[model samples]
Target: MVKRKSPLRKFLFYFGLVIIASIILIPFYYMLIVSFHADYDPYKTSFNNLTLRNYAEIFGLIQSTEEAFFGDEITKRNLESINTKLERLKSISASKESYLTYVEETLIPEKEKELRNMIELIMDFSGLTPENREEYLQNAMKIGTKEYNEIMENAQIILSEGDITLLNDLYYFLNNYKSEEFLDKELAKVKEQINELEEQKQKIIAEKATEFPFLKYMKNSLMFAGLGALFSLIFAMLGGYAISRLRFRGKGMLQRSVLVVYLFGGTVIMVPLYQMAVKLGILSTPFGAGVYLIIVYIIQTLPVSLYMLGNYFRTIPYSIEEAAIIDGCTRMQTILKIIIPLSAPAIVTVYIYAFMIGWNEYLFASAFLGLKSYKDLFTLPIGLNAFSQSAHSVWGRLMAASLVSAVPIIIIFSLMEKYLTAGFTAGGVKE
Candidate 1:
């Protein structure tokens, strides 16, 4: 029989654990807070000042709030001016003459201008037109049937495809300017637009998770790491099976030396690997750089993968394979249908380990993909590092990118943690 811990000891143990956990979590908390910041000012803790513009900027959505969604100063001023006049006209409950006079003089001109500017900004950002921002802004100032048609077509596309909800409402509001009931409809639409804009703003803020470059980098990373992990697992399974099952000359030496790749640090082999890549012309282009990275990742992961799976295959009872052979299964079929199924835990663990190595490898990735021509092929780690070193580097955005970069690995490790534990210790188990 075992005695339970006293209440005081229990409290202390839990209290210490809480403290340690808090310490570990503080940086993540800081990252979350700063990612919502409109600008980098750590001392400014006012809830009002926090914003999700950082995330938008990452996507290259708005160039200035660090980006915009009908949130720019000129747009804000125009909106305020029109809304004020609209309110005044509504409150007065004036006759047609008075209402028409006020609407014509104040609201219609600004609303028309607002519509034009809004469309131009929207189209420019949508990148549907070959025209640049300045060109589009200039075009936005002018209005013609051609411009209106283009705006309607492209703006429709933007509304259907884009995040901003205001464009549709704005188009409707501006269209109402042409109707006689436009005066009455104007007040209601403005209120609806304000509420809708606020809602859309909140939604965008919530999704401000990764930047545009990050998407491309993530794709590169996924391709390199994902393919590397898959092939490494395949080759490792083959090699590991041979080593564990078949008797051959120098088998013991081969088993012992399987981990020789890890004996010297990766740095020691970097020069040799670099020279090999250069000689093989694997780094000749960006696509070639990717191929090179994948090959290197396989090599990096294969030794341990082979060793782990070899041992784990040993833990799987030989009687199972014998049974498969007796049932007319081929040797390959026995390994696949029998060996692999029983060794699922070890297989998953080794695959994840291989993935982690490729996913997290920064040194070789940067070294190989660091050329200016290969910028698009830069993996997440390399891209994040470049962002941090750039002139526009902000702590908030950097932290956000770093956090996003870590998510895939965190999720994988969390899911496969049990397999990892079982696989690592399975070698010690006797049949």
Candidate 2:
């Protein structure tokens, strides 16, 4: 009979796995839930209130409703002010003669005239004309059932065409005053002010609703991390090949000291690194920050890269390299043609490792590039930190952005993971 491990041990092993997996997955599940629901309440939102708008907003697909609301608020307030004054004036007047005189002199000609200019901009677009439109000053009571009906009909047409400015003006003109022939021009003026309000709102949204900090930070991170990973891969491969293949002075000491950077945690060396960067002036400009970050990333990746690749390089048989030399291949040509192609899997692994260090690193990046003036050079980690601390309470957006940032790591892993499993196993592993 084949010997078997105890069932109790297997049970405990699976149990531990389940517990650890839950610990990791619970927060991720919550973040995903929150991303889908902007107004997330733990107790509620079981079936309703789910939306993809959070993703849409982060990716620049749609504008946030809160932004749209604030953009329109200026015009809304002005509309309310005009309405309030008109109501107050109506109540204070002693009689119809006085009310007509005050409105004609103060409200219509003065308050309404400024708005009238704006309406003329899109008069042709308004869909109102002589037959249906009420004339403003001829008789205040000639806005009959037929004219009122015609305005409503045309307002719907304006609305369907997405001319909200014109629709609003029509509604304002209809509700505010009893009308006549002059009412047509008066309605036109209301359109102008509403249009101005709409323009102001559009302008505000245009300024704020863009793919900034996200796209910018992504670019900086990619450039810094990309260059770091590439250089680390190249230098690590060379160093690893030298150590594994060449007999040189202090080789043992060099191999041992290569990993010494890892002994001091980032917190331990952070102050020293910051001081050094300050002296070097690498924190002075965005270009400097980028250079420093790339150097830092290389440091973070190189030690592990050297160790991983060095050990893996040793597993390849020495006779293959001897054959390359017999074929008159130079040392560098041997590495390029024989060793590098054979070590493809390990190189990819080291690259992925280096990339991850640069991508997810926060402590050094923040310490070195965290000056307020250098915000344009912020990496994804720095941008996310600032985003989370923003005064705007956009939890859903934050959650969405956090997940979106992880996509690159996921993609990199997926595209390169196939190379990871067969490095030393098939590459002539030996002591």
Candidate 3:
């Protein structure tokens, strides 16, 4: 029979739990608060500019705030193009009615001077008599059927004769006959493009490939962590079963070796693992980095998994396996059908532990993954480091990204919490 605890002892136990819980939870609460801030420092928690824009930016939901959007380099380029068109329009507007009448007296003389020079050149080319020359001049000014045909034929002849300069002047004058219509349409197209860009400021525009590869980083992290957990669980399950139940020579030594490997610090093994990865030609690639990280995680967690599962398996009586054997079950089948069912709590605990190890590992990932060139292959932690180290270091964005990255680990723990607690507290098959 167990003895009951006194009220003071129970009170201290609950009070201690509360203190430990606060110690673990306060940082997370701070992170959450900072995630919603536009610009915040822990020393100044005034809650003035709190927003979800950081999350919006991270998920590519919005390009940026309206002010930042307009201030972007692309916006500046578009503005320069628009300004060029505006300047051209200003020049073209000098010929409009508002300004034309004030300068018409001087402009008409200049125009007549050029037209007279053109008429003399046409006469020299056509070589017409006096009456024909007068008719040609009148027709050229008014653009009659005869004059139009004559000008067209003459222009073609000049073009074919390689008189490009004179032909260009003639074509320019003719093309600008409806100058307002032509310039208006050209100006309209440019303004339309500018307007579209302005509209884009209100929506998300993630076209800048150099900015952030959010989705790629998220996917790589999930893949690396998920696979690491799965493979680690598989190997740990087999190894734990063998250590706990199977008979073999040097088994104690093998168990000791596992413990030693788990106890080995990452700093001690980093250089050797890196050299191995280099030799294997897996450096800088997603597969190479992921596999290397997964292997390290498996080695790291396998010892704990083996120890916990071994102890759990010990509590399951050998009589159960013998009973299964008498019922014609193979050794593998007995382990699978009997041992696994009894060890679910421990398995879940180890799996969650392995996943967290893989997900949160930063030192080796940064050292081995070659993050500079292969940034898209970055895990969340590496990406976060890169983000924080960038020139525009927005703490709010960093906090938001950190919060989002931690959500998966939190969810995994939440789902497996009961199993983990059961693994710690419950023993098996006591008579």
Candidate topping TM-score: 2
Each model's lDDT comes to: 0.71, 0.68, 0.67
Q: TM-score for candidate 1, please give it.
A: 0.61
- Give each model a TM-score: 0.61, 0.63, 0.61
lDDT of 3 by residue, 1-431 (tens): 99899999999999999999999999988888877865523245466666887687778776544245423455445545655655554554544453344234444456556765665676577664456667666666544466756765675665455554654454454435346775465455545665665555333333432355566778887877778778878887787788888899988997776557645777788889888887888774766776777777677666666766777788889999999999999989988999999888777787776777777878777876744356767887787788677644566667788888888777876887787666546431100
Which RMSD does model 2 reach against the true structure? Answer: 15.5
Q: What total of clashing residue pairs does each candidate reach?
A: 2, 12, 0
Task: Please give the ranking of all candidate structures by lDDT, highest first, separated by commas.
Answer: 1, 2, 3
Cα distance off (Å), candidate 2, residue 163: 48
Best by lDDT: 1
Regions more than 4 Å wrong, model 3: 1-26, 39-47, 64-210, 213-215, 414-431
lDDT of 1 by residue, 144-219 (tens): 4455567666666566545335555555555555567776665566556656655554444443323237678878
TM-score of predicted model 3? Answer: 0.61
Q: Which scores greater on lDDT, model 2 or model 3?
A: 2
